[model samples]
Target: MKKYTDEFKLECVELITIQGYPVRQAAEAMEVGYSTLQKWVRQYREEQVGITPKASAITNEQKRIQELEKQVKQLESDNNLLKKASAFFAIEMNKGGKSR
Candidate 1:
């Protein structure tokens, strides 16, 4: 694997977390793998939140927790979309029923 400098890694993480660049866009601009950039961002967040033991230390459990958090976020987003779609269809159905 190609090694990246600490400063470079921090800058990339900052681009996503602090500078408001999307992860994928930053990764593309940096010419790094998308997953690699994501891992760096996760590590940065863990450090910022005090979940990580150190800058270079991440336990398997911490990794699992991060993965679970991502899943929960995705599920919540999906639920919101579904709820909106259901409400929209319900409104349309009510309009049709009123016209019948």
Candidate 2:
């Protein structure tokens, strides 16, 4: 396998993480393997978090947990909106019943 410079690896990781390019797209544009770019990103994040590079890896489970947490926040917001709507409709119904 060909070796890459640390600078090149950091550029590739920045393209995906900072520039918002997808990993596959960044890898293809940089002429590197997709999995190689992903590993770089994981390492970059580990370093940012002050973890030993070799000892830290972000697992798929962690990604899933992040996604699930976002979904839960969205659901909670929706439930609150529904509760407000229900209360509004209940008041309307009471008003109409009294008028009849």
Candidate 3:
């Protein structure tokens, strides 16, 4: 499967919803699958109404939330790693001092 950017997906949805383009016609013009464009439109509509999608986000706000959530997860993982390393080095230092 090909990955489409959030901007591209939003533009395609706008072409159909805002620009008065038929879903099938827009799909053909944009070289995307008809069903894919249709799905994007549906998701766009749902997002506008404050629905949080289970799949990848279609709107800018949701996309930012997803990005931030990913960053938070990464930071948490790095923090855990750093804590472990600190504890390991502290133990090593204590052992070395005791042996001197």
Q: Is candidate 1 or candidate 2 better by TM-score?
A: 2
lDDT of 2 by residue, 1-100 (tens): 8888766887898897889999999999999999888888988787666454433234344445556767999999999999999999999999999998
lDDT, each prediction:
0.81, 0.79, 0.91
What's the ranking of the predictions by lDDT, best on top? 3, 1, 2
Candidate 1 residues lying further than 4 Å off, grouped into runs, are: 53-100
Residue-level error in angstroms, candidate 1, position 7: 0.6
User: Candidate 1: minimum summed lDDT over ten consecutive residues — where?
Assistant: 52-61
Query: TM-score per candidate, in order?
Result: 0.52, 0.53, 0.70
RMSD of each: 13.0, 11.5, 2.9
Q: After superposition, how far is residue 61 of candidate 1 from its true place, in Å?
A: 21
Backbone clash count, each prediction separately: 0, 0, 0
Q: Per-residue lDDT tens digits of candidate 3, residues 1-100?
A: 9899988999999998889999999999999999999899999999888787788999988777778888999999999999999999999999999998
Q: Lowest lDDT 10-mer window, candidate 2? A: 53-62
> What does the lDDT come to for candidate 3?
0.91
Model 2: CA > 4 A from native: 55-100
Candidates arranged by TM-score, highest first: 3, 2, 1
- Pick the lDDT winner: 3
